[model samples]
Target: MGRNVRKRRSPLAVRAIAASAALAIGGGGLVWANFYASAHEENSSPNTTKAATAQVATISCPDVGQKLTNVPNKARGEVDGELATLDQQITAAYQRLATTRDAQTRDASFVQNAILGPLKNNRSVIIDRIKLEISRVGGNAPSSLDGLSSCTGTPASQTNAGWGNNGQNNGGQNNGGTASPAPSPSASASAGGQQGGGQQTGNGGQAGNGPLAADFVDITKVQANVPRKARTRAGGSTGTFTTSCGVNANKKFNTDNVIVAPGVSNGAHHLHDYVGNQSNDAFANNDTFAAAKTTCANQGDKSTYYWPVVRIQNGTQDFDQNNDGGGKEGNVGQIQQVKQAQIKFVGSAKSQVVAMPKFLRIITGDAKTTTNGLANANAHWSCTGFENKVQLTQQYPICPRGSTVVRTFAFQSCWDGVNIDSANHRTHVAFADAQGNCGNGFKAIPQLTMRLVYGFRAPTLQNGQIKNAYAVDGFPEQLHKAATDHDDFINVFDDNLMNKMVNCINKGQRCK
Candidate 1:
C-alpha cells in the first residue's frame, strides 16, 4: 500500500473521508473501490463557508495565560520539563498512527487506548505536579499545554518544530516526528508541500496557532461492499443477491438514544440499544452477560440488539422529549437507518454463508456524533421472503407463502485484519462484502447479520429496544424506539470475534 502525507484539514471533514475510505481487505483479497474526500480542498480553504472545527470543539484551558517571566527560574524549568515530555508522548502516538504497519493500530481507538488515553492520564499527573510546584513557590499553575487532544493529522516535519508558543520557553522541542513511512517505488510521500522539510508548522505539531483536529481516528477508507458474488436468478450484474428480515414499514423516529453509540458521545451524547452482554464501553467487562427479552422467535436466545433511539418531534419549533426538538439534527429527520444487512459465515464469499463469530461486536454508525454520522453508509435494507433482492426504503414487503418478516442489518466484520476492538468501536472493524467476505490485508472473522424478524404487531410507538420504548432496561428517560430510530448489533457470546456465531447464520435457510 502507498502512503502520502496530507496537509492538516478540518477534523470533521478529514474524519468523514477517512472513515469512508477504510478499505475492507478480506483474506488475501482486496475489494477495489474509489476512495475520495470532497472536503480535501476545503481543508486549506480560507474562504470556504465551512465552519472551522475550532467553533465546534472549543477545548478551553482555564485562563492562566500569565507572564511567566516573573516566576522563579526553578519553577519554570520544572513546568517546561513536564510539558515537553507530555507533548512528546502525544506526538509519538500520532506518528505511530500515521505509520503503523498493523492497520488496527492506526485509528482513533488506538489513539485513545494506546496514545491519547495515556497522554491524558499524564496530563492529570502534571496538573498535580503543577499544583505542588505552585504550593512550593507562590504562583499560578500553568495550563497552556492542555489543548493537545484535538487535531487533524500533520506531517512529522511540522510536529518536530521548536517549542510551541506556551507562556514559558523551557528549551528543546519534543517532536513526535510523525511522518509517512518510506514510499514504495509506486507509493510517494507528501504530494502537496515540501516533502523532506518538516518546517511547515500546522496544528500542535508545530509551535504555531494551527488548531488541532478534534478527532484523530483514521476514518480514511471505509471497506468495500462489493456486490455479492452469487448473482440473482438472472445470473447477471443487474440481478440482486441479497437477504433481509423484519417488517420495517416506515421511517418512524430519530432521536439521540444513550445506547446506539457509546464511549465517545455523538454530539448530544445520547445512549443506544445494546443487546447481548458486550456493551461498547471503554473497558471490556465480562463477556457473559445477563439475559433479556428478545424480538426473535427463538426462545432462550438472548442476542443483543442495538440501535439509536427515536422520538416523535412535535412540529412546534419548541423543544420537548415527546416532540422532536424542532430544528435539531438528532430529531427524526436526521436519523440514518441501516441500508443493507445480512448474516453470513466467516469465510470466503465463494463459500456458503456459515455461522458467525461468537462475542462479535459490530457498530454501524459513526459515534463521533457529527452531522454526517450516516456518511459511513453501513445501512443496507432487505426482506426475508426475498433473498434474491434488497430494499433501501422503510416500506416492508408483503410476505408471500410462509416467509418471515426479517429486517437485515449487516455490521462491519473486517478487522484491521488484527485488533478486535478500538477506541471508536468502528476503526477496528470495517464492513465486509455483501456476501460477508472481507477484502485483502483484512482477516475475515464471522460476519454478523441481524435478521430482526418481527412477527408481532408493530407497537404504536415502535422503539427498537427491549420494549416498544427507546429506553434501555433500567433507563426510563427515553420516549420510544420507533421506526425513525437507528439499529446496532453486538454479539456477547465470547471475547473473540470469530467463533460459534458462525453456526447461527444458516445460509440460505430461514433461521429464527
Candidate 2:
C-alpha cells in the first residue's frame, strides 16, 4: 500500500482546532480537550483535534419527533408542520453558530447567550403548539416534551462516537498488528480534487458543516464483523422477489417527505434521489401514488423508493445549491448519480411472509441519528468488494482503487397488521428480532433490502483534510454523518403483483 508521510494538517483543520482550543479556554478551561481525551483514549490519533470537538463544530438539539409516538391522526398534519419548524429553528441556530466562531472564541457564553438561548425559547413555543395540537384532538400530550426544548452544543468527538471503532485502535492502524499506511497523495488525487490543495475549508467539506476526516476509515484494515446466522427453519420464507427499478438516471430529485410532513414543501430539509413512483412529493397522497407511473420494470408496482442524495464536495454547485435545502442550508456539491440500485424483497427466516398492505410506508435508518442517538440508526456503509468482510454504521469507508462505495439497508420486515402508517411514521412496521420472529400482534412481511452503489472516486483523508469529500444530504444540524443516512419506501404494489411477491417468497422461489 502507498503511504503519504506528510505530517502537516490542512489549513481548515488547523483553524478549527485553534478555534476550539480558544473557545475551550475562553468559555471555561481545558474541559473540551480533557473530555475528548477521556472519550477517545483508546484510539487517540494525531488527528484527534481535527475530529468533531465539543467547543466548536455544530449545534446539538433534542430530537422531538422521536418522542412523539402517539400523535393523533387528526392533528398529525399540524403536529408534523410544527416539528418541521423545530428543525428549521435548529438549522438557523446552527448557521449562526457556524458563522459566529469568532464570537465564540471571544466569549464562551456567546453561544449560550446569543444562539442557544434564543433557540431554546423558539423551540419551547413550537413544542407548546405541538402539545396543544395533540390535546385538541383528544390525545394525551406528554408534559415531558417541555424538557426537549432546550438545546446544547455537542462535541465533535461525541457525535462521531456513535459507532465504536470495532476494537481497532489508533484509527485502524493497530489492526492485525500492522500499521496501515495513509493513502499516498497521488492516489488521493486520483480519487478527485488536487491532493491536499483543493480541499474544502471549515470543520467539514464544501458546505462547511461535516463528515470530518475522522468520519472515514480505511476499509482494508477493518475486520469482518458480520455475524453468522442460523439457517432458515423448515417453514421459513426462503424465497426472494426482485424488482428492477432504474437508478434515478432521469434525476428525479426533491426535498419533500410525504409520509412525515405532508403538504409541506422541503419537509425533508435535504435533497433525495427518487425512483419508482413518479408523483411522489410533499403534496402527494394515496391517490396520487396509486395513479402514478413507475420507473420499475414491473408496471404493477408503483412503490416509491427514495434516499438522501450523495454529493461530491469538489467545489461543484448543484441547482439546489441556492435553494432552501441546498447551499443556503449548508448542503453544497455536485450530486452524484447512483450507478446501481437493487431493490429486493426477501422472506423471513421463521415463517412464510404476508403481503404488505397498499401504501405501507417504511423508513429504514434515522436521518437525525447525530443528535437522536443510535436507537433507530441503521446505516450500513461498505465497499463493494469488502462488503462481506466488514460493514460500517457510523463511518464512511475509504475504498481501495478497485472498489466503489456501497450503501445497504434492510428495512423493517414486520407489520402491525393494522394501520398502513403511524404517527411517528415508524410504529406501523417493526424489524424482526434475531430469531426472525415478530413481536406479538405483528405479522411477517417481505423485508425490503436495498443495495445502492455509487461509482464516484472514493474520498481520501490526508493530514486531517478530506479531498473530494462526499456526504449524504441531511438536515443542516445533523452534519451529514454517515449514521444519519436513511432510506424511505412506500408500497404501492397492485394486488396482483403484491400477491405474486408473497407467493414467490413463501414458496421458496426467486422471481422477478
- Each candidate's root-mean-square deviation in Å? 20.7, 11.3
Q: Per-residue lDDT of 392-496 in model 2, one digit per residue for the tens?
A: 776788899999999998888889999888878888888777677788689999999999999998777666556677889988766677777889999999999
Each model's TM-score, in the order given?
0.35, 0.83
- Per-residue lDDT of candidate 1, residues 208-293 (tens digit): 11112210101112122123343322211121122222222233222232222121122122333333333233222223232333
Q: How many backbone clashes does candidate 1 have?
A: 78
Whole-model lDDT for model 2 versus the true structure?
Answer: 0.69
Q: Where does candidate 2 clash, by residue pair?
A: 52-156, 52-157, 53-156, 54-155
lDDT of 1 at 267: 16
The true-versus-predicted C-alpha distance at residue 12 of model 2, in Å, is 35
User: For each candidate, what is the lDDT?
Assistant: 0.29, 0.69
Best by TM-score: 2
Point out where model 1 deviates above 4 Å.
1-268, 271-284, 287-300, 314-348, 352-357, 367-375, 380-408, 416-418, 433-437, 450-486, 494-509
